[model samples]
Target: MNKTILLTGVVFGLLAVVFGAFGAHGLEKMVEPEAISTFEIGVRYQMYHALFLLFIGLWTGLKANKKRIVYTLIVLGIALFSFSIYGLALNSIIKFDFRSIAFLTPIGGVFLIFGWFFTGYFILTQKRIN
Candidate 1:
């Protein structure tokens, strides 16, 4: 799980850098400032969840079965949440309808919320190792 998360993190990190650079340079001419902000919003969520997934993987190794659920939730959350944002941003760039995808963003947000609560619950409920 840790290695899986790490690999995905590397992928996301690379994409973020590329996309961020594109936004900073090329996108400026093609898109309005608000569109750029929206694109950056997607990139920001992707980067954050990518790191969070890595942390969950690391935590899985140090923790118990109960905590593994937390990792699962986070991974799933990132899949749903980050991927939606990426799709939305890409669609925007292509002149596709982004409004339709707006509904999905909140669903993704719910997953992240669940992931966070699951982690917190697992932490509070965990027994310390001697």
Candidate 2:
């Protein structure tokens, strides 16, 4: 599980860098300023979550179930929140508008927030440090 989370985090981080470059170079011309900004926001959040997962991977003293929940929520949350924005930002080229379900970004944010809460809970509940 630890290796999986770490590997996933690494992949996410690498992709964030790739997508950010794509947004800057490829998308800058194709999209308007506002769209580019939105795409940047997606990239920023994806990178942040990727780093967050890396931290979670190194963290210790958490129970297995709590770690699972946090990891799952964070992974899914990053996909939901970041991917929705990516789709919306690229709608002009992708020929698909995901705005109909734009509400997911916040829902995904809630999940990410809950993951932090769970991590904090685990830290507080644990007595011994390794």
Candidate 3:
């Protein structure tokens, strides 16, 4: 589970850097400043969650079942939150409608919030090794 989460985190981090650079360079010319800013936000959040997942992966004492749930939430959060923003940001260029799925961003945010909260709760409740 830990290694799986770690790999997921690495993938996300790599994509974040790629998207961030694309936003800073390629996107600026193709999209409006507002769109680029929005894309950048997606990149920022992706990077944040990526790091968070990485940390959680390394943190000790989590049982397998609990780890699965936490990792799932983080993964879904990235897929919904970050990817939705990426689509929204690129909508201008791609000319696709994202309004129907706009609600997903906040829902994804909620998942991420819950993920962190659960992680904290897990840490607090865990028996400390002497």
Q: What ordering of candidates by lDDT runs from best to worst?
A: 3, 2, 1
Clash pairs, candidate 3, are: none
RMSD of model 3, in Å? 1.4
TM-score of each: 0.78, 0.93, 0.94
The number of clashing residue pairs in each candidate reads: 0, 0, 0
Query: Residue 32 in model 3: shift from native, Å?
Result: 0.9
Ranking by TM-score: 3, 2, 1
Cα lDDT of candidate 2 equals 0.86
Better of 1 and 3 by TM-score: 3
The 10 consecutive residues of candidate 1 with the worst lDDT sum are 59-68
lDDT string for model 2 (32-89, tens) is 8898899999899999989988887887766567778999999988988988888889
Error of 2 at 114 (Å): 0.7
List candidate 3 segments past 4 Å from native: none
Kindly give the stretch of ten consecutive residues in candidate 3 with the minimal lDDT sum: 121-130
Clash pairs of candidate 2? none
TM-score of 2: 0.93
Strongest candidate by lDDT: 3
Better structure of 1 and 3 per lDDT: 3
